[model samples]
Target: MGGESNRSLSLLHESQNKINSSKDVFLEKCL
Candidate 1:
């Protein structure tokens, strides 16, 4: 159960990073 939670956390972190980077790029373009 702990291992499964850890994997989920990492996947979430990765997806968050991807979303943040994409947002940064979009804001840069807008500016």
Candidate 2:
């Protein structure tokens, strides 16, 4: 159970990073 929770956390973090990077790209285009 502990291992599964850790895996889920990492996946969430990865997705969060992807969202942030996409936001940055959108901002650059707006400029």
Candidate 3:
């Protein structure tokens, strides 16, 4: 019942979160 889609969605969400975290770290270092 759409388990594969859910898995991919979660993976994408995690990757987006990682990108956001890295961006935040870079901004903090720049400040």
lDDT of each: 1.00, 1.00, 0.98
TM-score result, candidate 1: 0.87
**Clashes per candidate (backbone, < 3 Å):** 0, 0, 0
The order of the candidates by TM-score, greatest first, is 2, 3, 1
lDDT of 2 by residue, 1-28 (tens): 9999999999999999999999999999
| Candidate 3 TM-score over all chains jointly | 0.92
Candidate 3 total steric clashes: 0
Which regions of candidate 2 fall more than 4 Å away from where they truly are? none
lDDT of 3 at 10: 99
RMSD (CA, Å), each prediction: 0.5, 0.4, 1.0
Candidate number that wins on lDDT, 2 or 3: 2
Off by over 4 Å in 3: none
Question: Candidates' TM-scores?
Answer: 0.87, 0.93, 0.92
Clashes, model 1: 0
lDDT of 1 by residue, 1-31 (tens): 9999999999999999999999999999999
